[model samples]
Target: MRMLAVVALLNLVLVASEAITLEPCALALELTFWRMSGYLGYTLADWLCIVHHVSDFSIQPPLSKTAEKAYGIFGFSNKYWCSDGVQPSRNYCNISCEKFLDDDIQDDVLCARRVLTRNEGAQTWPQWAEKCRGKDLSSYLKDCKL
Candidate 1:
């Protein structure tokens, strides 16, 4: 019974720490994702759009066995949860569900682009999160309004 109480206390402490830790890191890390997502051929909005839809990090840009093996750590379930799950406030959903697990990088990027620009301008990750879906993808990148 004492051990159970200790475990519960530790869990609360760890959970609380994560919230505090993310306050500083979340903006930088997510902003970087927006900046870098373009390198993968995803528009800033494109990446945010797909990240909005994934149910799990394991499924985002779901890599095939060949690609999964190549990405080693990324292949591990929950590894990219920062971008996929851990960051509940941000939806860096760049890769489309259709291509999230796909092995073809180029194809995935194209699919992602389509998803992002499919609507007007380009909705940002924050927009998607606020609206809870893809909608306001503006032409250029937007820093968080906050």
Candidate 2:
């Protein structure tokens, strides 16, 4: 009985350690894409599509870090309340997610910019800043020219 208990505890610890390190929202992005793909959806094992394909630069600060990164994935973090609420396809472009996973920073940045543009009339500086993690990414987004 004592040996069994030890083995059970060890297994629990191993499971915990092997858990996915990606943030809840990040994982959601990949999962959403895969699910939206329907029967054609592709996933490397149980992991989401983005996880397997995300480039090194995708995780960089501000862009993929902080609240700004959350905006990229969730679009208006506060509106979604971080991880809950309906996610609309029209507001948040599905194309951008694919481009982001591909490490196409330009398109990814453009996606973010498009959202900002659409929301410009409705969002205040504070809301915009909060969504972008208090950073102005205008220059970064428009530089792509496409």
Candidate 3:
């Protein structure tokens, strides 16, 4: 019994150490790109060219994280809270465990889940930032001609 307890405690410490070193998620990629562009003196024309994949500077969306980089596959930081509730640590949340339909954004209350899962795609930044008027994505989504 003593030997088994020691092994279990060792395994627990290993797991905790591994979890703390996970990388920040890809949602931060756009901010990094813009910063690099600014440093390199890139212009609006350069951005257009890059977005359309017409140049070597074109951005590729990063792949989901692998298990070696995180506790799970698709290494997105699962430590996010919805518009409704708090997530305790990572991958665990206090949100209701309710199920709903895919075509369900019309209702205001139902929009919480969509907000939780929606991608910060290039297409929606305009509308999303508009609605998120007082929210904190402001500087990272700073005004830039593109």
Question: Which candidate gets the maximum TM-score versus the true structure?
Answer: 1
How much lDDT does each candidate structure score?
0.37, 0.36, 0.30
TM-score for each of the candidates: 0.28, 0.27, 0.20
Q: For residues 86-139, could you state the per-residue lDDT of candidate 2 as single tens digits?
A: 333343443523233332334443443454455552132344334333344343
Over 4 Å off in model 2, which ranges?
A: 1-88, 91-96, 121-146
In TM-score terms, candidate 3 sits at 0.20
Alpha carbon lDDT at 61, candidate 3 = 22
Candidate 3 local lDDT, 1-146, one digit each (tens)? 99999999999978544321111222124324434333334332322332222112212222236321111111122243221123333323333222111112122122222333464422222433343334443343344433
What is the Cα-based lDDT of residue 76 in candidate 1? 22
Instruction: Kindly report which residue stretches of model 1 are placed more than 4 angstroms away from their true locations once superposed.
Output: 1-35, 55-136, 139-146
Q: In order, what is each prediction's RMSD in angstroms?
A: 12.6, 13.5, 15.5
TM-score of 1: 0.28
User: Which is the better candidate, 1 or 3, if ranked by lDDT?
Assistant: 1
